[model samples]
Target: MVAKGFTVDLNKPLVFQVGHLGEDYEEWVHQPIVSKEGPRFFESDFWEFLTRTVWWAIPVIWLPVVVWFISMSVKMGHTVPDIVFHSGLRHICVTLMEYSYIVSFSYQTKSYWGNTMHYLLHGCHHKHPMDGLRLVFPPAATAVLLVPFWNLIKLLATPSTAPALFGGGLLGYVMYDCTHYYLHHGQPKKEVAKSLKKYHLNHHFRIQNMGFGITSSFWDRVFGTLPPQGKDVKAR
Candidate 1:
């Protein structure tokens, strides 16, 4: 969501009026609450925990598939093109299916934890975006879904293809996380970041249906949900 300016005081009680997902822009209510000043990265007790969680969980989810694909290639003496085409197609299909599942679940429940495993995984961030410590997903929670996701991938695609698709999908996840974090915290004077930051802020402020594309607006534009450009767009 877009703040008119970045003048939020973390040390004081602030009231945020958040629009519910799919709710009309005018329906927001002022929610007054006190929050502690979140610890800085180096000083936070959870810093090491967050780091280890991301490090361990990501590899656990995608590495076995990588090893499997490598072994399969060695065994078959497959060419790079053969691997790319076959495995890439499998990865794409599996990734799409997984994406659908996550989105569906998130929309249905409106809770990030119940829906997916990315930063803010579901819609929790929409409810509490300014909660700095909770702004990003905790690593331990990410580990919880790895086995289930892998098992689902196994059922949908061949062993060789599962890793490639999963790996590509993982790359997408990384891009999403980085872009999202930057959208919240980066001070970009360039056009691209300026546009994305404004787009995402609108998702927070005015148009929730639009700007669902975090890393890219590819899907948002295709789905006809993109918010209108410039001052004509209403802000709640």
Candidate 2:
């Protein structure tokens, strides 16, 4: 029987099972897979807990860094050419683009690496979509990605501008993670959120290849991954 988009495979031993690990360790380690579940991999509770619990502190951890960068830039009289941070519209646009880039990167990794990368970044979610404990981005994983991202941003822009851009991207990530959890667990009063939930759910159930965006569908539309025109959408 299928529960929350997963089915147990009787033919195979659960992933992460090793000889002589004992029943208690075995119970905690094994995760069953459904029809579309990707390859099974070992997961450590210590690491898993660290990732799941870090969500609450994300804003506190990153927002101050953004403020510091902007303030320091202003103090040092450093600014990006052709872009003024004072403009509300510009801030919004930059933040959105950065956020969209992360989503695009995720989709591209899945495409390039297939199930291996998907299992690392996204397929685990697809396998156990409703598991609230696993909803947020792991800090360990983020740190690995951010080091390279930080270097990339630094190369592209001035110090003053890079922080703000990075901060915006950070905020974008926060939004994406929050929105992803919400779509799975939130009931929205607004039509936009309702629509977003519908779009995301379709990605999970009806068409896994499409609708990669969580915070917004802008990238999905741009990348031609928008769900099919007549694809059935269900809200749950």
Prediction RMSDs, each to the true structure: 8.5, 7.9
lDDT against the true structure, per candidate, is 0.48, 0.58
Query: Model 1 lDDT vs. the true structure?
Result: 0.48
List TM-scores for all candidates, in order.
0.56, 0.67
Model 1 ranges off by over 4 Å: 1-123, 232-236
Clash pairs, candidate 1, are 1-201, 1-204, 2-201, 91-165, 112-122
Tens-place lDDT per residue, model 1, 46-73, is 5434622232344555456555644565
Per-residue alpha-carbon lDDT of model 2 for 180-210, expressed as tens digits?
A: 7788878888989999899877776776667
Error of 1 at 69 (Å): 7.3
Scored by lDDT, the top model is 2
Best by TM-score: 2
Clashing pairs in 2: 7-34
